[model samples]
Target: MQSTPATTTTKYPDKPITVIVPFSAGGGLDLTARSLEKLAPKYLGQPLIVVNKPGGAGAIGWGELAGASPDGYTVGITGIDMLLLPLYGSAKYDYPTALTPIAQVAASPMVLAVQANKPWQTLDDLIKYAKKNPGELKFGHGGVGSFPHLLGEMFGQAASITIEQVPFSGAGEATAALLGGHVQLSFVNPMVVKEHMKNGTVRVLAVTGEQRISDPVLAQVPTFKEQGLDVILTNWYGVAVPKEMPVQVKNKLSEGFKAIITDPEFVKSMSNVGLKVEYLGPQESQTKWLADSQKLTKTLQDTGVLEKIKSQRK
Candidate 1:
């Protein structure tokens, strides 16, 4: 069960603030929350306590956040999934409307990876093989309607190719499948395959987002656009509280979170874990939320992927 936030006092956050992680411990968001925990007291006047509420593909933790009191002490970690889950029946609340965005902290760049022993040396190499044998090359992803899966389908459209989709329980499983030669390709987090690449078991071909990753080693990999495929997909993380807070309280919380996320130490902490800290304030974050929501919705609807996700949730 989820724990309740401390009671609201005459002043905001008279007690510790709760930052919820929808996923289990040891994941990217968990690392992010732990970093914030160390930095919160200096900024927010109170420490942040992290609570794990994993289940239902993030619907559980986010749902709890949306239902939290709008008293400025019940914010939680958010992601691109926050906007996508409501489109399906999995989530009862729309994150954009139900919660107030505080700041965008980090993003995970997607990469196209293949087993090292495979014949693909570059994005072009993989494209040529896929064109030669349409629907013969299979790629693994977190699941249907997931960012990695959606990116895979969109890539085929942009590159004018037909490849098979093989969904897994999550990106970790999908990456394992790639390493074991169960699939020809996988769109996974760059960090997930970094160690495998070092061990000469995986070869990353191209990145999906506009920029290369911030990691010095991963930054060398060219983006999809550089390789002639104009596809951009990003998995971003942020902090948000329930909506309709007093204006002053909202601003205070927002500014505090911004300070913590952009601090030099916070930046270094995120960098060590393969996350890039890109801080966007409340207004800018909301603009991005609406833009991403529209773009992804159109992509899913056009490709009939939206209906598949809706059906799966039902």
Candidate 2:
């Protein structure tokens, strides 16, 4: 049985608690971590400090967390790429076993976008074009094994077409490349690309969710399944700490995050930036993570990306 993390009864954190981000300062993860820093201190009784350790698709920061003291003073933000990177050969981190989940903060479904000038207006149009052109159609993502990159693989299978993938260092760069016509298409998080979409820089072909967002601005955008494609992928964000943290500290961290995640003001602030608040504490969050990771790993295996990993494990 998995050992449960104990709630922190003894007040830790004589000084500031640090929240490490595995990406640059202006990315979505960095921005959300900063937003949480603004509110987390009130519930945890210690001011939160955000430290960026960007590199290796998040291996550097995650590696630092793995080596840090498990005293609940250090926790960090990880997303879908945390699970996909290993399979894609980007990193060797075993996220499922390395970090203990505290809570899930928010989730934004991926959007299949095309340059505004592209002739493809719908997913079907893009699919047809991809089938006709084979590997001519290109798409951009943050990195080789990032969520968007693997998501593009799933998309190729679901749409039964071929596409060339171009990887960037981060979403901001990927968005810029898409806008600059470096890539004709991209699978981006709606929250990150909402402004560009609204400004007419890119056209949203479909959102990877079952229902459209409540935002009036996305009312006309259809879902991928609605357009006859089968896929549901989201850029999920959450808080996690070193696996060996004491139960008391773990629960305190979980409870503190739960409080902030459900707060109206916190939710509004995150939503204002296009991140819809979705809270799942510890056990629930872990289950979701495991399930999603399993699905993603399975997709990788079936798609041949997991071939080397499987052989090594065997």
Structure candidate 2, residue pairs in collision: 5-247, 6-247, 6-248, 7-247, 7-248, 8-248
Q: In model 1, what are the clashing residue pairs, if there are any?
A: none
Give candidate 1's error at residue 180 in angstroms: 4.6
Question: Which tens-of-lDDT digit does each residue in 1-314 have in candidate 1?
Answer: 34556665566667898999886665566778998898998999899999988766677898999998888878899878778788775688988999989898987878999898998898898898999999999989766666787888888888888988897655566777888899999887776677787788988889988888767767788999898887788888899889888888898998899899989999988877777888999898999999999988888887777886777657
Worst 10 residues of 2 by lDDT: 305-314
Among these predictions, the greatest TM-score belongs to 2
TM-scores, one per candidate: 0.84, 0.89
Residue 170, model 1: Cα distance from true site in angstroms: 4.0
lDDT for every model?
0.83, 0.81
Q: Give stretches of model 1 more than 4 Å off.
A: 1-11, 131-138, 180-184, 311-314
**TM-score of predicted model 2?**
0.89
Instruction: Provide C-alpha RMSD values for all models, in order.
Output: 4.5, 5.6
Consecutive 10-residue window with the lowest summed lDDT within model 1: 1-10
Q: Which stretches of candidate 2 lie over 4 Å from their true place?
A: 1-10, 88-90, 308-314
